[model samples]
Target: MHKRAQVSVEYMAMVGLSLAAFFVIWLYVNSSNASIQQDLKVGFGKQVVTRLADAVNLVSVQGSPAKIFVEVNNPEGVVAASPSSNSSCSNVEIMLVMTAPDGKTTEVFSPVAANVSGDLSFLVGNPGLRRIQVEAVDFFGSPCVMLSG
Candidate 1:
């Protein structure tokens, strides 16, 4: 009877150890996944912001009839907004408006998102404040830049 009790206790202890090991492994896996997700979010956000800033800065000082297009290029061809992976950005709109000193405003639609690479194009004509507004769900579908004359 004493031997049986000792063997049972040993078996229970072994089982407990195995469970603990599994719990530890699970914790590590969960933690790693969380870290990876955070990194991806940050990276995507930066890409969007950088592309916007770049496009804005590229044409801020230029006077023109300019047409610009922002492109999103990625190996997966999927540039999605936060929390969901949409193959393309559906909420993006870009408009170019030239406000004249005489209080005349001429607005034109700019290409918001295209799946391509290299310099983008925007059409704007005249010497004034040319406003370019780009709204998009993601920036990973193509290389983004503003090109104009």
Candidate 2:
């Protein structure tokens, strides 16, 4: 009887330890998934900002009014897009608001031009159909304006 009781206690202890280990693994996996999701959201924000900057630069260099479309995820909205004076050069700063899966909002800034000559008609809205219209203007001191389509 004493030997049988000892064996039963040992078995129960082993089962308890196994359950604890399983619980730890489950918690780790859940935390890892959450971390990966946050990283993906940050990466998406960076890609969108970089693409917007590239599009604006391309239009300015080509000296043509063009409509560029950008794809975005669950974006909160565009906060601001205007020409701002940096230390040495004037750049068009595009501020985009993005939301995470946890309902957290973040602002991403993309500088378009290092030296913007004229005004840029930057109109961006709707995450599904983001439209940006760049106006062709004279880079030199001469005044020039191009009509938008």
Per-candidate local distance difference test: 0.40, 0.53
Q: Judged by TM-score, which candidate is best? A: 2
Per-candidate TM-scores read: 0.39, 0.58
What local lDDT score does residue 137 receive in model 1, on the 0 to 100 scale?
Answer: 22
> What lDDT tens digits, residue by residue, belong to model 1 across residues 4-26?
99999999999999999999999
List runs of model 2 lying over 4 Å from the truth.
72-91, 99-105, 114-149
Clashes of each: 17, 0
Clashing pairs in 2: none
- Locate the minimum summed-lDDT window of 10 residues in model 1: 74-83
Question: For model 2, what is the C-alpha lDDT against the true structure?
Answer: 0.53
